[model samples]
Target: MAAFDELDPLSGRKVLVENNLTFHDVTEAVAAPIEIPNARWWGFFIVSVMMLGLLLVSLGWLFWEGVGIWGLNNPVDWGWAIVNFVFWVGIGHAGTLISAVLFLFRQKWRTSINRAAEAMTIFAVICALLFPTVHTGRPWFIYWPLPIPNQMGMWPNFRSPLLWDVFAVSTYFTVSLLFWYVGLIPDLATMRDRAKTTTRKIAYGIFSLGWRGSTRHWQHYEKAYLILAGLATPLVLSVHTIVSFDFAVSQLPGWHTTIFPPYFVAGAIFSGFGMVLTLLVPLRSWFKLENLVTIKHLENMAKIILVTGTMVGYAYGMEFFIAWYSGNPYEQFAFANRAFGDYWWAYWIMISCNVISPQLFWFKAIRRSPLLLFIISIFVNIGMWFERFVITVTSLHHDFLPSSWDYYSPTFWDMTTLIGSFGLFFTLFCLFVRFLPTIAMAEVKSVMPQADPHFGEDGHHE
Candidate 1:
């Protein structure tokens, strides 16, 4: 087992994983929270439920009163609901990137963070779905966007970007859920085997599908996982690309741009990683998982934030440059209005938080500091939200006609609903962290030399 000590190939330093951890240690550490609930877990859980209740209350009032309760008006019909929709959808991308794209590239570091990231992806999508459902003001009619047959004889407009979003998001969520659950089966089986009580054993056994850890079962699991990863990699790109289409395909001056697909995808990854860091920083310490989710892992994620943040900043500049270069008066005015109009503050907030703050990661000290990284990640989240706000509100507020130009502000219901969405996200995340393996224990073990048959007893390659 000593021969299994992970080493950084570049600097030859010991890697982030603890050298002495065994397979049993991984199982016990991951399963402990499930078998035993602590005060801290319950404390967070209760808070999340309260927030979720707020969401329910807000929605109930929204349904009872109507969409008129929102601050939406003639020019700005989108308001905060669309802004939040885009924000939450963008935040889901990082998990798919980590779980699928990185897996296809054979990046071993993903093992430490992929489980939580995938779970975040699923939860974020759930939150994202909520806004559009409620935005329709008739949650019961939500299925109208789907291609199902109806008595009205009107099928969904296949050419509509909104319809594209319906298909894209649903497909992404389904694939992500399957990918996440498939990965969990082996770990669930491990829990089932280790369960002390019959109820626990039976519950886990059902979800585990009676996994026996046989060589053939592993072969099938690996094949299915690889296939899903292959399928999901394209989805990681397509889901957000289609999402950007909701804006880019429109005739709207600020949104209709060739650069949106790549730009939105980059911003999605940036925000997603920010959220991953924000959640994991506290989680690592809370669960005493510092040894597994090492500073190197944190550093790697920060580096990603730096790179994507730069890309997003460049996109910001490019949008302005193109607006000016195109010589289209509407586009030019739209970009200028964003920078110097009524919502100018929001534009600057987006720039400062998304572009400037992420630059701090260039410092090795900051990248390695969990506290600073966590703080910066929160800033990135705020900035990304503001970015959506600036794009959605600023563009629509001052379109072509001055008569249609109107100021947009979220009502109390809007504010509460948005906050409630966070509650929904955190509730799901808390449940995931509590019951499931926060880390991919099987994958982590597979990366260790101790799991390799070819390694010699003398701590040398055979």
Candidate 2:
């Protein structure tokens, strides 16, 4: 309620375009944070920077000590590092979903939030990359993936899922980056045109590629964006599928299931939208973007979370049934261990967060209540992380060899490194909103009615 005061002017209407905001107002609202960030923005920025500092310090310590500083043992050699990598990667999925899939389907509501979601995808991928890089321990020689000769001159096993990850993740990052940057060109041009300082003008101009908003420019922009969306849509499915391959191809009982690909994809979008909700709810409130990022927009995203969450829950249930049906005792134990064994806490937390909490969206009021929506989003994020933890650690810790079984516990460095990734993500995001327009000003304009277009006063738009 405190942050969403801007919505009061709309009375009781629900539309993609709200409050009769002029194009000037749209551009100015988004640009204002970049031009003159307030104290609250500074507070968030500084906190994120501090977390980024933690990341650097922890990474430095990790580099000095090696992966041994982590709580990796014979049973759980793959620890939070892999879990964090998948978690971050999954978080990035919602961006492409919003930017590409929805756009391809002509969902105009995406216009208001796609820019920030796209930025979030980029930042989330950056964080995802950090874990696997450092997880190698000898990150300096990480270039072994290149076709060139290394110290040993032995080529990496191309069959390795790790290698697949190298290609899958790199491709995802490259395409997502290009997609995000292409979308920014017009907005960068707007900033350049608005610039009062020569330095700012030059900086924005260089990136904007001399975008003149001409008919030809718009035509080319639309074509390039469409092509990139086509490219990115499949990457959304493939990237996470490949990431799941890191487990699915393994002989481990819990990981070897065929269900992992679609399951992880569903979970990824589930968590991705959860993160989008977490960030945007507060952002729209803080920046007074309620008109642009309307309740309907939030509700649409909530519906996605609802659908995906249900898909994820179904996948969870099917995994248990598949295990039992296989008549493989090891597989049976793997699923049972997840629920009733050492990691039961993580399993139930995942269930509550990913499965149960999203059910609240069935109630219209809950989806529309920003505070309630934000709260559930937090749960969804927490639950998704626990889901990854359960999937990674539970299966590994209690594998076939009972003698090798050991409880996994993260060391201080491990915890710090995991927490620090958030710092990197938020720091990038803080800088993004502080410099770039958070909302797509150009796209939002297309949705707004120029005529006396207050929502049909009869409440039909709702």
Which residue runs does candidate 2 get wrong by more than 4 Å? 1-14, 149-153, 450-462
The candidate maximizing lDDT is 1
Assess the local accuracy of residue 403 in candidate 1 as a C-alpha lDDT between 0 and 100.
81
On residues 1-462, what C-alpha lDDT tens digit does candidate 1 reach at each position? 132346754446556467467777877766776678789999999999999999999999999999999999999998888899999999999999999999999888889899999999999999999999999988899999987888999998898999999999999989999999999998998888888999888889899998888998889889999999999988889989998999999999999999999999999999999999999999999998876888888889999999999999999999999999999988999999999999989999999999999999999889888999999999999999999999899989998889878888888989999999999999999999887889988988887656767654564553
What RMSD does each model have against the real structure? Answer: 2.6, 3.9
Alpha-carbon runs more than 4 Å astray in model 1: 1-16, 457-462
Q: Residues 297-395, candidate 2, lDDT per residue (tens digit)?
A: 888999999999999999999999999999988889999999999889889999999999999999988888999999999999999999999999999
Q: Which ten residues in a row have the lowest lDDT in candidate 1?
A: 1-10
- Residue pairs that clash (backbone atoms under 3 angstroms), model 2: none
How far does residue 411 in candidate 2 sit from its true spot (Å)? 1.2
Tell me the lDDT of model 1 at 256: 93
